[model samples]
Target: MHLKNALQKYPRLIVRALVHPTGIFQQIRQERAGTVLAYGLVIVLFNLIMTVLAAVSGLTPELMLPMAIASVLTVCIGIFWLHLFVYGLGGRNGVGTTCRVAVVGLTPTALLGWIPGVALVGFLWSVLLLYLGLQELQDLSKARAVLALVLVFGLPLLLLALLAAAPGFSVAWASPGRVTWV
Candidate 1:
């Protein structure tokens, strides 16, 4: 589907995905990979713009490029793990199909990311979408799908926490009363 159509359908699709995920998954499965990629690219660009805006608002230059790259890479890696988890959970959807679901599921967050204080909303919404997507696309029990998402997202977050606590490491943006240390 085109971006306009996708945007127009966002609210309805979110409701449908939550209420009847199988139908949503079927719709996502039928999406062309190129269209999904286009949608994803828009997210990446929007993320970059947000990063730049943050920099303008006093975020350090040293963190700018890395943040931009990381923002995009996070989405790419998220898609990869999404596909892996679906397969591991015995879903027969191909990689492209999984990617499409992820892209569409994340669409709201991706589009609204520029607004301050909205990232959390987008994130929570995307999590719900992913949870539903896994259950519907994989034909999995809710518990199993939740476990899959935990592995896909939780592990990395836990790892990052451990690594952050280790040695002298600190996330630059997280410095107390400072925009960055570097």
Candidate 2:
């Protein structure tokens, strides 16, 4: 496929992922008050844990404040992204609902160090959601599902690897070449 044609097909693919035959607006209409309250509580708890961890990690007040802000932003963006993947892209209500619940339920793990263990859980969850979403794509053949999976997982990993490999990446320290603090 030509690059222009491939790029042109992407928006339709994304729209298919974002809007459902059931009507995206209607799904929002059907959400219950209790569900909203529960979601609110989850967000609050997730942010609280992240804030505490940031403070404990010795992040300066200035940095902690911004990190907390970033954490909240990440959660919000994750919600929207998952919503698009599960509801808009995936046709089955249960899969989308479960994925959303799983993402929110797992947010407390943000307090964990940014190591492979922590990152892996998030990565696996995303992969599972993509698999579920792919299963719902009536229009996509198996070859397309494989391509989608590559696009979904590969780009993020590539970017992460690039960032990690970038020059000047270093662990922050109070003193250079000294393990002990005064």
TM, every model? 0.71, 0.38
Q: Give the top-scoring candidate (TM-score).
A: 1
For residue 150, what is the lDDT in candidate 1? 89
RMSD of each: 4.4, 14.3
Summarize candidate 2's per-residue lDDT along 21-72 as a digit string, tens digits.
Answer: 2232233234453443354454456556656665567543434445556756
- The 0-to-1 C-alpha lDDT of every candidate, in the order given, reads 0.69, 0.45
What stretches of model 1 exceed 4 Å from their correct place? 1-24, 50-66, 167-182
User: How far does residue 2 in candidate 2 sit from its true spot (Å)?
Assistant: 57
